[model samples]
Target: MIRTVEVREARELLDHLLPLIASPWLYVVVFAIVAIDGFIPAMPSDPVVIGLAALSASGPPDVVMLAAVVITGGLAGDRVAYLLGRTAGHRVRNPKLVMAKQKAERALRRHGGGAILVGRFLPYGRTATAMTAGSAGLPPSRFTLHTTLAAVAWATYAIGLGRLGGETFARSPLLGAAFGIALGMVIGGAYTLVERRRAKTAAEEPEPELVASGRR
Candidate 1:
């Protein structure tokens, strides 16, 4: 009897929470979080988007709007970071920022297109890449194009994963959220590991004569 009561209470709480999660304002909130996250890596923008996307399964949330908002927010935030780096010039002294800049430069040097695309999935990777590109005086056209593509791809992946989780566990949104979070973490960890390995390998390898000649 106690277990039954507890289950009922939990369901009631979820029921109440679903409406808020599905509210139109939820898109606005998600936009704000994602935008802020670009400048501040500590923000939980990804998880929030995933959870709300799960809640959207049982509500009238507009998935298209959600995706659009997320993409817009991410791009906005990245732009801000880029501008800050551009304005800072060369006097940047923060050790952490310096490290981020180095990582960004290495990724850019080694991967080029892949760096901008894959960096979106890694923690702090996107910010580092954007800032580094700005500091390096990358052409505005090139930066805009790559960042836009990356943002769209990231939004699609995040929202699609959430929807899949929501559909799989429709009866319990909490379960769906948990599943989505777990799946995201797994994917992120695996991607990070692969990228690190690839970077290490690239570091150990020597450039071909033709590539060296092109640089000269």
Candidate 2:
């Protein structure tokens, strides 16, 4: 009963909020959401980008501008997170986050420029990479170079999915947006699942044996 009420209320709130955010300010709204989400993993910026891009098929905020805004927002937000990590990295206490941070640090060390690029698709991945990079003392030039590439690729991927929905449902804006958001969620979920499976497989592999000290 409570879950149903909450869902209904959330829908009502979304319906109420949509019109309020549906104009020239739409760009600003999406940009802010994506940027803030860079540091704080609270909002679903991917769906917003996908939905807006799908609506762009109906011809309002130009697709180019929307794409630029999302990419720039992602870059800006991640850079800020990186900056914050420089000061706050040592303060992490939660066991899970600590493990994640250590893993990200190792990835940064092993892969150098593109570690974060590959991981950005996973949930909370941007934060993990940026923060770990900053805390790990990774050079700003290298981090920025790769993160820029990652942001552009991420934006393109999200917008592409939206465009797919828009093209498929040319006459129905709502349907296009709904389809795009759903598709992004499905793909992101699948990617995360695959990564987890891979991680498990790698963990289960046995390490090579070392020679005994007297054998030589």
Best model number under TM-score: 2
Best by lDDT: 2
TM-score of 2: 0.82
Clashes of each: 0, 0
Q: Give the lowest summed-lDDT range of ten residues in model 1.
A: 1-10
Kindly report which residue stretches of model 1 are placed more than 4 angstroms away from their true locations once superposed: 1-19, 89-97, 206-216
- List RMSD in Å for every model shown: 7.7, 7.1
lDDT of 1 by residue, 74-141 (tens): 99988987787688736656675567667777766666545667677777777777877777666666
Instruction: Give every collision pair in model 2.
Output: none
* TM-score for candidate 1: 0.80
Score residue 130 of candidate 1 by CA lDDT: 80
User: What overall lDDT goes with each candidate model?
Assistant: 0.71, 0.72
Candidate 2: worst-modelled 10 consecutive residues by lDDT = 1-10
- Candidate 2 local lDDT, 120-185, one digit each (tens): 676667777888877767778877888899899989988888888988898997688778777776
Cα TM-score per model: 0.80, 0.82
